[model samples]
Target: MAELVLVTGGSGYVAGWCIAELLNRGYDVRTTVRGPGKEESLTQAVSTVADPAGRLTFAVADLLADDGWDAAVKGVDRVLHVASPLGITAGDPAAMIAAARDGTLRVLRAATAAGVKRVVMTSAANTASPSSYATEGTTDETLWTDPDDPTLIPYRRSKTLAERAAWDFMSGHEGPTELTTVLPGAVFGPILSTGTIGSVGIIGRMISGSMPGVPRIGLEIVDVRDIADIHLRAMTAPAAAGERFLATGEFTWMREMAHFLRDGLGPHGHKVSTRQIPDFAVRLTARFRDPSLREITPSLGRRNRHSTDKASRMLGWHPRPAKQTVLNCAQSLIAHGAV
Candidate 1:
């Protein structure tokens, strides 16, 4: 068999698309799930987009430990390190940070040891900018959150630490391995399986009246497919080495998505709402309740836009409009009975 492109966390919500795209693009891929028994969900997800060419394979792996990772990359040609913990629910903050940073380094260490040529890591805009959780305006590659800052969100801090550590290891020292990072912001798009989609949970709450009022924060909502595309391009483009490409769309208001949920799905969909709480009102509500709301206040009335000139000029990468990405996700969610 030909060598496969190894994708960590292949069973993930977003990485699954990248796995399929790799399969479609004629690269045999080996993806890792947390355990051996969990292959069913991963296979079902990849099958949704795979062409039945039998090009995808699964390797059991975990982010918090190093039991089987070294062997997983033994014969792989390249590695797509897309497996990282996301969303803050419950767990040791220090452990999460350790797993993200150490676990990523673990794979790179294995890839380098195995003589793998290139590695594409899935990073986030949060790592690129500290104010990412803030509710307004545009943030790009220029921003980097202070790891020592107490105000940073746990999940965001972990991503920043993990990515910076990886880059430091690969570039700061000479090695046979090369690195490329894809920094995506609030990615949402087509579903590869029948499950809860990315961050669109906030959108559903808005239209269902679950969220009595929309918060004033803004997001640079890029589609998952676009994010997946960026990963693929980074893997093949020789110029992508040692670069962190910001993959995001124009700024979008929180409630504006309700219109997308209602009007955009048009002709065959649900239309729940187009109403919103004013920025001042949200600020007031945020004041009495949570400090997280303070983070939401900055972008209440602005758009966080970015230029794709670099990714475009160099790798021919282009993202569909944010509106279209939202529409596709909304439709996928409804079709899958998630909405």
Candidate 2:
């Protein structure tokens, strides 16, 4: 086999795509799972999108523990740190932040200790989004999310803090290591396997009619395949060192998304609702009718736009537009009989 690459959380929806890209590119993969027994799932996920002859190995590693990560990194040319504690609503912000910040630092420390030359971390647009406050002006990579803002989502806060922790660790590390961060906006696209893609549940719920109206949020989406490609590019592309690449394209709001999906299915897609719910109506109705709407009410009427200018210039990355992302997602759900 050629040089090996270590992928953390290979069984995860996002990481699974990363591993698939690595395997398709003919990299020997040593993936770390929270349990060694989940090797079947990892192998299956990789196999779903990879060639039949791809090579995959697995180890047990927990982000909270220091047990197997060092060994998992041995002889690997690059590390893809995609593991982080992800949750929507949590009882404790400190616990969530620790899992994100400390968990990332732990892996980086292990990578340094194991002499890995390059690391491509899975970051998110949430790290840089200004959704907590009114985004008056155009925002891009230059902006940082206001984590202390009371309106920030717990998951967004976790991602922002974790990415910040990673940058700090990289700055202080004396090792001959390079770190590249791939920050994708709210990701949506087809699943490589029968299993679910984690971040797409909200979209899926909307498609399945479980969500009557979409979140007030807008998504700057790119294909999962495109996001995975940038991770690989970030690993070896010399210019990508110490860079944060935004793997995204144009933005799509709730009504735009519904239209995109509805257009795709022709007859079937017509079932989608394109009515834009007024922010006040949804908010007021939530108190008397539905709590689920209340859960997503905080993000109502927010505009989210991310600039991928740096990505195109530095990594030579080009992402599929958000419209295609929504269309493909709807098509995939229909093909899989989920819609």
Candidate 3:
């Protein structure tokens, strides 16, 4: 009998790939959805990569509520807690924090009670970054961002707090279930469905020419497939327990990414603009045009990058080139008619 792995939030961009990769590896997979209606979309998405057949199943669960978590964790050998509230600008920052921090605890409590062998949680790279990204250096998992820093964005604070809460919960836990975390940066790659692109939506917008010009921002690109691979490695690696691994690839600026899309996609890439938007123009636009732009204004000239040497050394993980990842991402968006 194959070991059953439970993936929280099955209908997510990263979670969908995790499920497909697990099914391809011959693991019987079960995933949590907020409602029964979402099951069809998840099933359709996962089926695109691997034949779910009878190996894939779904459970109703929500991070904001604790109703179906117990049942979701029951009988699972391992868990990948990939579900969390994410937004650049939230109407209520505290609510986002509560959902991320409190919701993580809910999953941990259930996993510990069920005696699951291991739980690999998905965390963002921002959780391990400094408050100011102006410093030009490579940081590792050893550095922990201060979530209480008022300068931190809501999403960054939520992710940092949630990961911190998970570690704190395990510190006092006497259970046999082990915990590990995989922190990924700017997840990009093929989209399983057009419904749930998550942060990869930025690439979609770029490919569709939604933005007039590129901002002076950069991202440490990591493929969605690579992120899924790291999650599975963390779940099974003995050295991964009670450890956090940063999964990041080459850092590329928005201008470079725009150029990549424009040169790589041929006719389809014609819409992608390689022109850089002035930082002052972006700041001025944020003042009245869009409130969400305010959140990213701080990162207009980000210079820092993350070191994934820990993930490479410990788990023997290696990510594909950033150009390949970016080109594939744009191609995927085009194929899916999402652009």
Residues 1-339 of candidate 3: C-alpha lDDT, one tens digit per residue: 999999998888899999999999999999998878987788888888899999999899888888999999989999999997764225788899999999899999999999999999999999989877577788899999998788888888999999999999999999899999999998899999899787788888887889789999998899999999999999999999999999988899989999998898999988888899999989999998977788899898888899988899999999999899999988888888998
The superposed Cα distance between candidate 1 and the true structure at residue 75, in angstroms, equals: 0.4
Cα deviation of 115, candidate 1, in Å: 0.7
The C-alpha stretches of model 3 lying farther than 4 A from their native spots are 87-90
Candidate 2 RMSD to the correct structure: 2.3
Q: Which ten residues in a row have the lowest lDDT in candidate 2?
A: 131-140
Q: Can you rank all candidates by TM-score, best first?
A: 3, 2, 1
Model 1 global lDDT (CA atoms, 0 to 1): 0.77
Counting clashing residue pairs in each candidate, in order, gives: 6, 0, 0
Candidate number of the best lDDT: 3
Q: Give TM per candidate.
A: 0.89, 0.92, 0.98
Candidate 1, residue 284: the lDDT equals: 81
Clashing pairs in 3: none
Residue 101's lDDT in candidate 3: 94
